[model samples]
Target: MVLAYLLSVIFTQPVVTMEAEAIQPVALRPVANLKAKDTPNDAGQSIDLSWELSPDSARVKRYEVYRAESAKGPFEKIVEFLVPTTAYTDADTLLRNKKDYYYRVDVVGELESRASSEIAGPVQAKPEWFNTNRIPVLVFAVVYGLLLILYIEFAKRDREMFVRRIAGLDAIDEAVGRSTEMGKPILFSFGIGYLTDVATLAALSILRRVARRAAEYETRILVPNYDPIVMTAAQETVKQAFSEAGRPDLYQEGDITFLTADQFGYAAGVNGIMLREKPGTVFLQGVFYAEALILAETAHSVGAIQIAGTNMATQLPFFIAACDYTLIGEELFAASAYLDRDPQLLGSLKSEDIAKLITVGLIVVVSVVGTIGAVLTSVSGESGILRSLTEFFNSGFERLVSFLTTS
Candidate 1:
């Protein structure tokens, strides 16, 4: 009996050891104080969530946020991973203000997570009417507006702000006089642009000056238009110009005619007009495409005094090669200010020119310093005054760029 009892005790001891080994430890610890609210100054499509960190957060590496449309929950994870800052703004609510949203935050670890003891919210989002990020742009716009207004006021006083005389605009009197002396019509077209184009508008401004001269000189002006809208604007422009020149009776309705909208077809009509009329002066200003060379070469063949102005860099070479006088780049844009000498336009033009000169000076200084610095760095690894000057210039340039772009 003693021997049997000892064997049974040994077997029973092994079974009890196996049962103790099978038991495992649980890893979850509940997170606390989860809350959700509407995000401020946002479109009605966002909710802000927050929670307190778990006291047993030793294993917590991230927080996960889950959201559901109802309290009973088929909760879906909204955020994949977030740092434990107890704050998360959910910005994907969409057009769902009428529905309540419930939220849960989980303390996440390597392989598991402990959810918040209670769900966060029945929250709704509201839209803000204004965006604060555009404040910098608005402030700068106001500053520039004030500067423009002051410049205009000063110009009106005839404060004698000298703007450089544009050679192309200056030659206008010579061209118009030649047409008047020859007893022939002057052909004027605003390139092949729609009326909405600013280049076309600028061309129209110069035409106002041209039409007034034609009216005063008792010279005939023929304007062939590619767009109907441009045709209407041109007629009105000429009529007003004639009225201003005290020759509204001389304003001919047939002078400004609408040609086909087809680009090459319009060029053909202008070419035919040039051949038939043999105009003494041809004014081509605005935007042009491939037809620029065609019109310019034809005008040259007609032995006409051609004055052309265009903002298109590609067409500028054609005009320069053919026309007697060509207004390059921004000169075309400033035709009004040059011709009218309107105090407001003149003041703005002078101010802009000054700004451009300043910009050029800064670019030149920065370029020289940078070049010198690079040479010194290549020879002696920036050990001298050249290097120091270069670094100072570079730093100032960087600051200026940052202020302009990022502010």
Candidate 2:
């Protein structure tokens, strides 16, 4: 009886030990110190993370990094299954100021081990320095500013400023004159886009110039628009232009009409207007889509001198093929300044050119240096002064660029 009781106790002891072992939590250890720092290129935000190779991680698999807006967090995992590494960088961009962020790291092996550390303090980052990525932009800005001053000075002195004739613009007078001779109204379509679109603004600028010329010629100008806002704005702009030309009485609201908002519907309506009015000139300006070809084709069929301008690269080719003259991307904007002879606008154009020159120079330098570096590395099997020179030039230029942009 005594032997039987002792054997039973031994079996029970094993079961109790096994149950305790199963319920016990595994320990997690941190391999690196947790660090927090402000993120670059933003208003204000901080990132907190750590690196660690867990002893049990080989069996367990990955790690989880948890974050809480407050120190007491109902902590939630920000990163899950992170591979073991010596460092991690937090790159969250949208964190606001004064908002505390707490973090904790956990080693998750075959199963989840206990968190390595307690929840970190609620910390927030203040807005740091402005980014320097816009150095090239600043340089261009300065160059343009100087050019504008010079142009304005020349304008004050009544000095003749020579500008190259833009084919698209030079045809405007002829287009309006043709309509007058034919006794047909001119049709102008501000392409399908919002009033605030850059292309729409460009179209409006040109329209003002066109309206002034049309008013002086006593020619009827018809504008069909798809966007209600644009339609309203176009009416105002045309009226203003006619008024400025001392022919406000000639301005008619009926001349500026609103077509359907549908893309194809607008195109069809404009095409019909072209067919019925037999307008001698059709000005298609602003943003356009597939309807561009359809409108251009219809205008061409009517024997009208079609002038089109748009920034959309894809639509440019269609315009080039169909229209008599097309204003490519930046030209659309530049044309307005050119027509108005606005010093500020001209200045901006000059600045844009300077930026382009700088960009091209940098590209050429980088390409040459990179090719030389590759060839030297392959042939010499060792780095020399040539290699050092190449690296210095590339790195120095990059750093200078970065500083300018960041500043």
Candidate 3:
């Protein structure tokens, strides 16, 4: 009986061991056709790797990427993916330019069982002079540059370049004259903007024109600033304008004064000046925020003719509501060219308009094609002719949209 029991136990133990070995996880198959190449249209120090998925992809837990300086190498693990993947870009900072790189991809399975592909190597990363993806942008830039040169030559030859009249800018002389007639001060506020802002810079150009006009009219102009730097610039600009107007003695340094840097504080100060001095004209030009309406409303209350301009879209509505003349976004930027009529500036502005026309035309064409494609796709009942037309329009639309977005 004891011998029989011992025999049965030995037989059962061997069977249990065999069943356990059968149920153990197997090593996943390695990925195939691994390829590595220099990344296109990019600066050096990047390599693109691609490979075929493993036959045992169902069993794969993750993919691991290993990189080395040479084919026969101590490869360092660079990256890993928890899900199945076939491509990776090794853009690690440690990768040096013009250096050869070798790569291997491993398909890892449950219990860390892994199979590695044959190493792909001898690929070097090099920078391209120009990115093909940005060719559209390059073309646009070249065209704009050529247009600028052409228009500049025309302007230099005294050819008349047409510019639309901006009523706000045209009214500057009128505003200054009214102030002179009423015996009231002309107030200009650079609304809570630093000297670094483009809106503020544009405002400086407009201020120069206004200051020159005021000097000619012998009107007292008050410039209240939110920034000290802006105040200094305003002083210099006014001084220059006064000299140009042949009224250097009329330029008062005290008029272009810096108020508190705080947004609301500056608004309160300017509002107080408007109320007390009863300025005949108020120019609110530059960057503005919540204080825009406050200042504009106060100037309105004091019976001031307000001319407002800003690039801030959020504050434009308030300015338009309260001010007599509002210079919308691009109009404010075009002030320097309009006021100065510099040949170079006028040429640049003309080129900008041409570019805008081209952009708008492309947008319209793309929208028409995409809409037609979508409509045909929804209605066509597997007709060959309709399918062909749909493909043509959709592909064209997609390409154009992609180009526009990338450019």
Candidate 4:
């Protein structure tokens, strides 16, 4: 009986040992050499994280990275199922200033272990002066500066800058001369528009020049306005122009008169003046609406030499048909610089011309290259040289355009 019992015990012991070995858990080593870097975006809101996978977990499915507010943390997983070779970027939009954060990485497999990497300290990146989006703006500034310099150089030589004669300006002296010959007052109407509008300001500038001439010729100028602010500015401008011409006494307050704030009402008053005064010269230089035709036709009937200038696209055709001379959109603004010969304004105009030239050149190049590229793409031919040349030129032209626009 004792021998039989010993045999059974030995067999049972071997069986127990085999079962325990089969159930033994795999040991997971801590991930090694963790690193963090500031994100390149310069938003001060992100960091890049990287680490080495443990040898034991090499065959494991994925890794997990954890973050915590403190070193001894109830760590929370920030990223999971991450490939061992891949680095992760963490963008913490909720990050608070001067706050501490800790990070650790763990290797996870079929059988997970408690081992993890040493916690990394909180890191903060300083804000940058420029953002990525500002690159275009910087490029533009450089191009603009170069263009401005070129314009200044050209202006300094007193070179005869050729500007196409604006029909409206050409009619100015003629209108005043006609008024002088006819011995009739010249009716000047600065349409009801705000001072801040570019068209209104252009009109004002033209008014000063016309008023000076009217003063010199001893021709009466009657200005009807629709805006209070415009009325005030027009009065001041006409008065100054008259004073500049040494005809201060000839400046009449009633001449730079305010009609009404209402557009139609002001138009009626202007029409009435056109009929009643029957002035030999009529100057319309401001923003006008449907009322433009009415005023122009009325002035035409009175046999006045009409000169109109405006930037309103809708009203341009009517003025063109009815007025003896009319200033177009950009031409109206150019006239101010032409008459005044302001260095800054003239420089700006020159820059604009350079910009236009660059734009046209780019358009032509793009059209030609695009056609070539399309033809090459359609044919299954080796277009390596053509492709490379086109790409190079396109990139260069784009950069040049960006520079000009920003500068």
Estimate the TM-score of every prediction.
0.63, 0.77, 0.81, 0.60
* Tens-digit lDDT string for candidate 2 (1-407): 99999999988999999988877756656544555555555667656455556556555456667777877668877676655664555556666666778777776643355546556556676666666556566776776567667666655666655566688987888888988898877888888989879999989999998999999999999999999999999999999999999999999999798999999999999999999888888999999999999999999999988999999999999999999989888878877878888665665555556556766776676567556656655555247886676666567666555644453
lDDT of 1 by residue, 65-132 (tens): 88998887988887856555667788883537646899887776654535455887687777778766
* Candidate with better TM-score, 2 vs 3: 3
Q: How far is 319's C-alpha from truth in model 4 (Å)?
A: 2.0
Ranked candidates, highest TM-score first? 3, 2, 1, 4
Q: What C-alpha lDDT values do all the predictions have?
A: 0.83, 0.78, 0.92, 0.79
Candidate 2 regions off by >4 Å? 1-34, 45-62, 68-102, 114-123, 132-136, 154-160, 341-359, 362-380, 396-407
Task: Output the TM-score of candidate 4.
Answer: 0.60
Lowest lDDT block of 10, candidate 2: 109-118
lDDT over C-alpha atoms for residue 168 of model 2: 90
Whichever of 2 and 3 has more lDDT, that candidate is 3
> What's model 3's TM-score?
0.81
Q: Going through the candidates in order, what is the number of backbone clashes in each?
A: 0, 11, 0, 4
lDDT of 4 by residue, 13-129 (tens): 999988887677666787788876666647566767778778776656677888777788988887786566546777767755345667788776655545778887775544555
Winner by lDDT: 3
